[model samples]
Target: MKSLVALAVGALVAGGIAFAAPASAGCQAGWTPWGGGEICDGPVGSDGNFERCQTTGVLGFGGTQCFIANVGNAQPPRVGP
Candidate 1:
């Protein structure tokens, strides 16, 4: 029973999805802020997860918007579902 409980907890942790700054913006998906607004280049398909605001890290409230690029470089190619 203890092992089953542990397994359940592990599954729960694994099943949950982590939303990063870039991920929330849908920019890089995992890209995060190193601070000072340094130029960032990520691998293709790489996701950015920036964490600047202390409040809820979603779009509109200054969280990474999934529809806009945080940086001023060319946007990434849109991926098809």
Candidate 2:
């Protein structure tokens, strides 16, 4: 029995990945804009000057590019799981 337990433990350790589960959560949609973000009214819009977080995404002069879930709340980014 001890040998079986030891073998199982050894195999798990060797696999490395079994140590812990992957962290949940990622850049949520309409949560916040990232990269160059998106433009709502037009593509050439500027930050704050032209765009604002909306349900569809950072709206501006053209249209939205980023997902809506990534650009809504005014709260700072947080870890989600």
Candidate 3:
């Protein structure tokens, strides 16, 4: 019984560690860390600049989504033409 309990505890601890690992792991190359997720600059488009976001839940078991958005161009407006 004691061995069984120890085994269960060990499993739980291992699982917890695995689940928490990604939260601290560095983002992939070119990606930057964001609030509990990672993001990176996306390709510029005719409309504007873009940013991509990727989110994942613990152990990637659920609540994973990816999206891109336009953040507008960064150039200042011309004056005194």
Candidate 4:
């Protein structure tokens, strides 16, 4: 029984790490027009200006046993004082 408990605990820990890895869901895409016309492209901000941008993990699973890992895009933030 004790051994089983240990095994379970180990599995749980691993699983937790996997799920916690999705920690880049920032910015949700908002502004747009860097050199097109208006001129408003700057959503960089970890400690500066930021607008919106997100999407870096499981969003919309498909049918049976579906899966939707990290997609991409929306990334411009990581400043400091």
**Alpha-carbon lDDT of model 4:** 0.28
- lDDT of candidate 2 over 20-76, digit per residue (tens): 232333322322232122112212223422222312212221223432322234233
TM-score of each: 0.23, 0.21, 0.31, 0.25
Cα lDDT tens digits, model 3, 1-81, are 656544544444334433342333222211112212332344556776454534333222323344555555321111011
Worst 10 residues of 2 by lDDT: 34-43
Question: Model-by-model lDDT, in order?
Answer: 0.29, 0.29, 0.35, 0.28
lDDT of 4 by residue, 1-81 (tens): 656544544444334333342232431221112110011123454554444322111112111121222213422222111
TM-score of 1: 0.23
Candidate 2: segments with Cα more than 4 A from true spot:
17-81
Please list the Cα RMSD from the true structure of every candidate, rounded to 1 decimal place.
14.3, 19.3, 14.9, 17.0
Number of clashing residue pairs, candidate 4:
9
Candidate 3 off by > 4 Å: 1-35, 49-51, 59-63, 73-81
Residue ranges of candidate 1 with Cα displaced over 4 Å = 18-81
Stretches of candidate 4 exceeding 4 Å from the true structure: 21-81
